[model samples]
Target: MLAFVLLMAVVGIATPQQFWPSLSFVGNSLADIAPFLLLSIAIAAGVKATGADQLIGAAFRANAGKAVMVAALVGALSPFCSCGVVPLIAALLAAGVPLGPVMAFWLASPVIDPEMMLVTAGVLGVEFTVAKTLSAIVIGAVGGYATVAIQKAGGFSDPLRGIEVSTCGTSAITKPAKPHWKFWDDKDRMKDFVGEFRRTGWFLLKWLSIAFLLEGLMTNNLPMDNIGQTLAGLGLWSIPAAAFVGVPAYLNGYAAIPLADTLMQMGLSKGAALSFMVGGGITCIPAMVAVKAMTRLPVFLTYVAIALTGSVAVGLLYALWGGVIG
Candidate 1:
């Protein structure tokens, strides 16, 4: 990625005047989103440091249906990225938490969060952000309950058949000790919080910077209307096409936002945009790899099916009722 950025920089240097617009676009995007992005990161750090995530996981050690609902809601609200959520999923499954709720959180964790929402609203619109948030929760709940039903029907003889507790690495990552939020009261936690803040802030900065840069380059160089026409003219096919394409070719959620906005500007329908986000964000290779590593083949395949089906279903609903809802 760094190499690609450097290569683009060389290109920009060669056409210095033409690249100025791209730079300006990047600047504007940064300025617009900086405050919301910082606020979100602070909130996420506080949540993580306070052991809220572990508390949520602990709550799932009860009745299946209620567990699934709680897990789904946590997944929707928490600011966990796929990479961050993987260890938690491992811990939950290894500690005898049911597969249904774990799968629910896994499917929804990467799709949206407060930070992602603010960024989306800044780059896209409030409507897109709101719909995407609702879709994330709905997808998680549906996937969880569906897994429960499947489990009850003898679909999974032993959901954790091949999974080992040792494979979970350590509980520390998944279940951090309850923290003292006051900065001075716990020096160790404060250090941890600061480190997390740095890491997360850097992660967001790098990816979102890349996204804005790409957006700028595309906006300045591409004939977006021509490309948009190709995608837009597909009509109903566009929704599934977006989902299918997104599954295999997804970048991270942060990067996808600017790209989605660019596509919308070029004439992509709201449904197609939503489908692309759901498919790509939920089924991205990293998230899938994490799910596969933690579950048996049958469970892994079921997750894939759920993600695709839910994405398409949500897309169809939005396409049908988006105008009335708006």
Candidate 2:
């Protein structure tokens, strides 16, 4: 899609000298941000392979309620983008972590993460970043708590009751011998880290490539101007509408940032645009299919419900703020 966009811009500009500036504008935009996308993927893979996710899962298993709150808090602090959060969520779920907390983590991670917050500040300004961060925390905490309450009330059940736990310990031990190991035991941290990097790196790479391709295609081909015009005055409907539009499109969170900027510039409400970008990032066909394969229908639907509700809340809040401010 990046290539196609570049090509089209070149063609468009060559035909009309006035459009030449558009080519440089778009090219510079793409170039300026591509590295962040790559870095997000690498960090995601590293976090997954380093047992960070398992550690989180174990913490959750120890105390479900506290774990849920802690998960929300940690999500706020972590730098992982929405795309980065996906694998971590899957890992937690596979590790028998409860659905409520996982939902919380999913909802909170993208909106509250440090990297995203910084980027949000740059793209939308500090006020918007603070609003998004606060909203994400509130939504994640409420969603997590609500999910737990609902489940305890017998509204949902474990979906992975029959699955076997695959041990990564043995594989961690025999992978390779590395230098700088203490002649004594328990000093091979570097080797262990390297092994983990390889495993998670591969997983993240596969999905990142797919996400980039989808994003590129959307950026190049989707009629952003038309979408902006159509969604202009819908107000509250914008949130759910954005959610609906985002699902099939399957853009990663970071990829949607530029698109969100375009929509906001075109008079789409900030709340609605944010909601759409968040929904597009976390809830998609690919993500749902992945979750379904690992768990059952009830659990999968629970996640979808949490994400949709959280995103809607984000949109509505944005709308409320916009109304007051405007």
Candidate 3:
């Protein structure tokens, strides 16, 4: 997408001056999130270094059904970005963690965090922020449970194809033995932490740099007035349309808040705004690319399907109660 946008500029479809906003947008977005991103990455490194993955693996191994709910809650609280979370997901899966709860955490972690929640509240209002936070957990649980049910029904038996599974650090088969709770006390473990941090941090910087660049282009070029007008008061179709357009049209979660607020003031339906946020936040380009690397075709497609379906369903439900919420 970023390449395509740049191509348009070179071909005269867009002028050089058009990118001025894009450059500023990219700069500001990075400036706003840089500190938080570093903090989240550091926290994730601590989780990986201290053997928390083993503890999480134990829970998922114990009862998959119960773990799905727990995973959703944990995902909401964690501030990790999609790329940062990918390494952790790989570690968990290779360690024999159940797929159901892992999916929950993956789907939810990118949508909202403590900093994001406060930002949402400040920009979009308390009610919208609260609704969005709740939506994250609901979307996660729904995706997780749906994956479980589908697996039980003989779907997704072998989700990975061509990707080799191996324990990241020590060996191929991760034993059920307890991890040294103070693993970071060892020199080898400190090395492991530094390696993990570099790996995940570099992945995040590379992908998100591109994603935000594309976002900047879209923000400056896309004619959002048409979207706001199209979604205004359209009864049933508005919800699905919002979710559908959100997949490709959204910038990112933080950028979307003010945009959604503007659209709402322009007569966009409340449900449409909500649906767009959930849809875009979960399946954003960077997140999808991260998931694609870790999952097979079937699992990747399933993730997309669950996100779209859940977003549309939630949009409809909220629309039905528009008399009150609106």
Candidate 4:
């Protein structure tokens, strides 16, 4: 299904004149994202091999609120890209971590990291950096709580798509089994490790291939300068507009800081700028692809909705009183 979908997307987007370059974009992107992909695969495989899910289950189930808060806070500070964060998410899900905290980490991890924050401070301002960091944490917390609330009413019963969750569910969290740190001693564990490594690696590469291909095509076709200017002129609508526009138009987080600065210099509203950064961080095509690859349809849709709405709310609030916080 993934292959057929990717093939269809390629055929639809890559015209004859653009086919080779689009392929090149996918190739280059794969190479560029290789470190994160390899690391993610290794982490997932290691967790499976060593039965570390036991530890993970214990950590998350202790106090749901604490787990969500810690996840949101760590996600903001840790420097993981959309692709780099997947293994942790998968591991958490497999360990039966509640969707709330998993979603918190998923939304926040790609938004702001220490390196990105410092670069943002340098490029934009210390004020902008601080505000964005707060935004990441706040958005994460809100999304997490919302998921928790909805799921309590029976919304996200099965949150996973590819990776299987714990059959023990809440029960596993209550009584986590002891893990075998030296998994190599067991032949079954060794085979599971190898199998997981290969499975996760291939899955990531394929999804990312399609994402990069779409990114390349979009990059070539979209009038980004015009889009930036449009964001500048939308006045009261600018915040929500930024939220929507940011999904497809956002550059990489590192690359985006300078661009955000440039857009602000060109009269982009502060609210719109903040909205674009936060919204884009959550819903950029690659991030969305990473998310979609892991979660079921209902969970994925809710994630997008919550992210965009939270970004818009944050942008509007910042516009009112960012100076006090920043």
Cα error, residue 294 of model 1, in Å, equals: 1.7
User: Which pairs clash in the backbone of model 3?
Assistant: none
Looking at candidate 2, what is the lDDT of residue 176?
24
Give the total clashing residue pairs for model 2.
0
Q: Tens digit of lDDT per residue, candidate 2, span 244-303?
A: 676655455555667778888878878887777666655754455445545678777777
Taking the tens digit of each residue's C-alpha lDDT, what string does model 3 give over 26-93? 56766776776677667556666776666656656667899899889888778776555666676677
Candidates 2 and 3: which is better by TM-score? 3
State the TM-score for model 2: 0.66
The alpha-carbon lDDT assigned to residue 281 of candidate 4 equals 88
Largest TM-score belongs to which candidate? 4
TM of each candidate vs. truth: 0.65, 0.66, 0.80, 0.92
- After superposition on all CA atoms, how large is the RMSD of candidate 4? 2.5
Overlapping backbone residue pairs in candidate 4 total 0
Off by over 4 Å in 3: 1-32, 46-52, 81-84, 118-126, 158-175, 181-184, 324-326
Best by lDDT: 4
> Candidate 4's C-alpha lDDT?
0.82
What is the alpha-carbon lDDT of model 3 when measured against the actual structure? Answer: 0.75
Q: What is the lDDT of residue 227 in candidate 3?
A: 74
lDDT by residue for model 4 (1-326), tens: 47736665666574677777777777887787688778877887888788887667667767777888888998999867877887768878887788899889888888899888888888888877888999999989888988988988988887788677764545534665678888889999999888988887777777777787777777678787888888788886988998888887786798778777888887887888999999988988888997888888899999999899999999999888854656
